[model samples]
Target: MKKLALNYVDTFKGLSKEVWWLALITLINRAGTMVIPFLSIYLNKNLGFTKEQVGTVMVCFGLGSLVGSWLGGILTDKIGYYKVMVGSLVLTGILFFGLQFLETYTQFCLGIFIVMTVGDIFRPAVFTALNAYSKEENKTRSLTLIRLAINLGFSVGPAVGGTIIVAFSYTGLFWVDAITCIVAGILLLKVLHPKKAKVLDTHENKKGKSVLTDIPYLMFFGCMVMFSFIFVQLMSTLPLFYEEYYHLPENVIGFILMTNGALIFIFEMPLVKYFENKKIQHLNSVIIGVLLTALGFAVLLYTASMYASILIGMVLLTFGEMVGFPFSNAFAVKRAKRGNFGAYMGLYSMAFSIAHIGGHKFGLESIKAYGFLQTWQFMAIIGAITVVFLFFLKRIIQKEK
Candidate 1:
């Protein structure tokens, strides 16, 4: 048992110093991610908004994220990712401070939009930096490290968020969240220099420069949109379901949400590495990953409100997350073809926006009209459909290759 534990520890031993800083940066940034997870709750419980209104407001966030992704992609190509990432963190933190005062619905919506707009631009830039900073052999592992850092910090966020909300109310959530973002920005500025970063543009060409003409990349982009449409429900609807249907308390909800991080922290890198070393196909990983996500939501149906049920669902979802997302990112980087890695990442990041529009809007309406059970069922069905579509899509991409 001791020897086995030592080997597990060694799995994380060989990452680049840049990768370590990136992970630390991600951990710091994500540790304060209390606002978004509880945004629906804040609107509902604190401000007395209806679910429909919350959904509408949330879509503003999605629209902002869409524009940000495009901007990040373009700006990364021009000024490099360092400036974009640092600016996003600092500016978004300032916006979060502004959020403390907005009480009216329209003001809150506009605030949400602005915050996410500046905040989300960081996504593609971070991935671009990650790709630049990592070795090609460690590409997928570096991506996994991003998720790993996120989940590790997230596990702390919800638990701390729960405590903050209890002691200070939702206002505390925003304040703490802002502090973390600003601190992360300072850390980034201090630790990572432009000269030290690795920008991978292995096979640049006239054709590689323009993602607009890349059909395979476009098809994959579509797949990512569809995937996010279903997967993002975990963020958009799952929390509401816990509050409205399950009647879970903030701390309990935090604990449940924390399970996602805990599982990934314990299992993902090791298991994902194990599967990759065994020569498993990337497509197979995605298929199982999507299916497991479907299963996660499905668990909610039979075991609604049960503590064990939520845990079960989280395990499935985390397993799916572990197997799938890194491969999906690997696929995007694979398609980069050289100089346009940031552009590819930006395009991929837009899927989060697509997911927000599709999942939040569609889900709120479904819950209002059909009920939570049916809504989750609908999301699961969408996941299943995406699997079939991905199967076909993978075949086409492979044939083209």
Candidate 2:
């Protein structure tokens, strides 16, 4: 056990201090991200929103994410990632506080859209920042390290969020989320001053360098959208399924969701290290990861025992996340070296935005129209198709190699 512990610690060695600082800031920010996972329940139970209304609002959320990601990439390239990251964190914090006040359906839609646009602007800029902070050889581990922080925070957020909702109300989540965002922004600003931080100059001066024309990158982007389309149900419809279908309470659901983060925190770095040492192809890892994700979804098809099915499904999904996300990040970072890093990561982040915009709506409507069983089956099918998509992208990447 001691030997295993030492080996796990070794995975974190050699990363720059700034990378750790970035991970710290991300941890603080993500720790307060209690709203999104519970948003569907809040809208339905708290505000008495219909399923279709919730779907529309989620679409608005996705649209905002798409806009924010695009803007973040542009601004990061033009002005440097430092300005974008700090501004996004602080502004998003303020937005979350005000979000709870918007009561009507239309108001909620606009509020969520604006808030997500501001909040998600942090994504691409942070990816670019991490790239600038870490050494090349340790990049994947660095990515995994940040993901660990995120998952750790996510693990706490849902559990605490569930308790907060039960103790106070949904409004309490907004207050905590708002405060955390501002604190993270301030903490980052104080520690990583622009004058002292390693802010790389964007290559805007170089003409004709654009991600729009890159076919391979675009293909990768499509694959990510599909992957996210399947994965994002955790936030959108899955919680509702827990509440309505399995009849679990909020705290239980929160605990179940928290398991994803806890598992990733305990295991992702070592697993990423093993894969890196093996020199496994990034896309090949992604293929295996996607397959696990599909299997996770399929586990829900087991109707014998509800608790067993949900717990097993969560474990499979968490392992799939542990495997897939870091390598996808590394692949994007490597590909970005061929062009503008901000643009590449921005588009990469936007793939999630595109998925967020459509995925939630699709899942919700599927549930409304079909049923949870059919929806899960369809998502599993999408996951399989995404694996096929990743295989094609692997071919393109090899040709480039």
Candidate 3:
């Protein structure tokens, strides 16, 4: 036990201060991630938006995310990760406060879109910085640490947001989210060093290979889009399901949301270490994780009477999240050639962005057409399809190589 404890400490110790700070930045920023989970609820309940209208709004957010993801890559490589991070943090924080004032559908939709566009650009930069700061051997674990920090913050955010919603209402949610984002920006400014920042994104360093040209990566990217479509439903439809179908209160919903982060917070790092020591293939880990995610949603099929089923589903879902992303990030990092890492990471981030449109927009439409239970069932079907697609993606890489 002592030996294992020592080894774990040593593993964490292997990361540089920049990596550590980046994890802190992630924790701080994500801790305030109260807005998106509740955005659908607010739009529907408070703003009197129809589900179809809400879907349209999400489509706007997705369009912004698409622009952000694609632009984030080109910019990160062109300028530097640190500058991108700083700008993303401060500007997006200001936007959050702006959201509270918007009432019209047009204003809210445009606001949501702009917020997503500016805010998400930091994502690729964060990944790029992680790669820049860590030892090559410790890279995947570094990814895990940052994700762990994100979950830790998420555990705090929604749970607290739930309470704030009760005590002060949705206004409280907006203020709290905005303040933390700005604070995170300031902290990031103070901590990161001048020179150690910014990996040169010049074409020479990138070897002039575009991710668009890499067909194998494009296959993996396609599979990622499908995977994200299923996975993103947690943020999209699940909360609404809790309120409408389950008739749970906002705080109760918050607690359930907290469960995702709490599970990952407790189990993800140790699990990452376990899998790393086992020397598992990254692709296998993703496949297993995706199946577990599907199984969790399938467990939702038992929501016939038991509210406890949601809890059960979240466990499987959160664990699947834990197993999937760190490995998937590693797979992405491995595929990048030199300087194009930001671009690669951007494309990877775009998977989720695109899924927001496909998952949330299309999903709301599905719920309208088919109903919630059937919609969830279809998500599971999509998950299974994605798994098959990934297997094909793996074979494509093998054949191409």
Candidate 4:
């Protein structure tokens, strides 16, 4: 037990102080992430919108995210991540506050679209900042550390958000989210300002291959889109499934989802460290992650014990996320070594944005048309197809090497 504790502590060694600061800011920002997880439920139960209407609103959110990510990449390269992160976070906070005022279906659809457009701009800029802040050898661990903060915050957020919803109202979530964003931006501005911290500029001036024209990357991008499409159902439709299908309460559902974040917080870093030390291929780890994610959903198909299945299924998905996301991020950073991280990570984020548009719509529509069982099956099949694509991507990477 002592050895195990020491091993976990060792993962924190060799990281730059700046990376730790970055992770701290991420923890604060993500800790207030109370809105998105419960957005669909709020629309359905409180606002009395149909699932179809909620789907439309979410698609709009994805459209805005797509625009935000593309614009963020360009701006981060042209200006710098410092300005982009500050502006995006502060503006997004204000927008979150404004969103509570929107009522009608059309109003919500348009409002959420604009808010997400501004909000998601933070995604690419933050990624670029990660590249600047960490050393080359420590990049994957740095990314994992950031993810650890995010999951830790997530573990806290939904559980707290559930209590807020119960004690106050949905409006309370916006206030907390808004305040956190503003605070995070201000803290970032004070601590990570370019004047104080050393941000690398070599990648900024270097011309790299256009992501649009990169063939292998384009293939990987498609696989990510599919992967995200399957993964996002956890946010969009899964809550609805818990509510309508299983008849679980909001707090119980929140705790169930919280289990994913908590488990990742406890296990992901050690797992990534193990994989890294073993020198496993990034593609191989990602393939395993994808397969496990498929299995996570498949577990739900067993209807014997509701409590047991939900816990087990969430455990599978959390492990899959733990393995998949960090390596995939490192892979993108490695490819961008020749060029600009802003552009590469921007396009990488855009894949999730695209999935956002399609995934929410697909999941909601599938649930509406067929049923939850069929939807889970479709998600599993998509994950399997994505694993095949990743194998081809592996070959392409090897050939390039």
Query: Taking the tens digit of each residue's C-alpha lDDT, what string does model 1 give over 1-401?
Result: 89978867877765678888999998988887678878888998888889888878878878888988988888877787899999999998889888989988999999898888898889889988887777676778888888888877866777789889999998888888999999999999988976665445333445456787787678777777777777777775888999998898988887787677677887888877787788777777878888998898888888635876788888888788788788888878767754477788899889768887776678877999999999888878888887887888788877976
Tell me the whole-model lDDT of each prediction, alpha carbons only.
0.82, 0.87, 0.84, 0.87
Best-to-worst lDDT order: 2, 4, 3, 1
Q: What lDDT tens digits, residue by residue, belong to model 4 across residues 266-293?
A: 7888898899899998889989899999
Error of 4 at 243 (Å): 5.6
List RMSD in Å for every model shown.
3.2, 3.0, 3.6, 2.8
Which candidate order results from sorting by TM-score in descending order?
Answer: 4, 2, 1, 3
Model 1 has a clash total of 0
Model 3 compared with the native: what TM-score? 0.85
**Worst 10-residue stretch by lDDT in candidate 4?**
199-208
Higher-ranked by lDDT: 1 or 2: 2
Q: Please, what are the lDDT tens digits per residue for candidate 2 over residues 232-266? A: 89876988999999889999997898787677777
Question: With candidate 1 superimposed using the best TM-score fit, by how many Å does residue 129's alpha carbon deviate from the native?
Answer: 0.7
Candidate 2 positional error at 195, Å: 3.3
Off by over 4 Å in 1: 40-52, 165-175, 196-207, 236-256, 298-313
- Candidates in order, TM-scores: namely 0.86, 0.88, 0.85, 0.89
Strongest candidate by TM-score: 4
- The regions of model 2 sitting more than 4 angstroms off are 37-52, 100-103, 161-175, 198-208, 239-256, 302-312
Ten-residue segment with the worst summed lDDT in candidate 1? 198-207
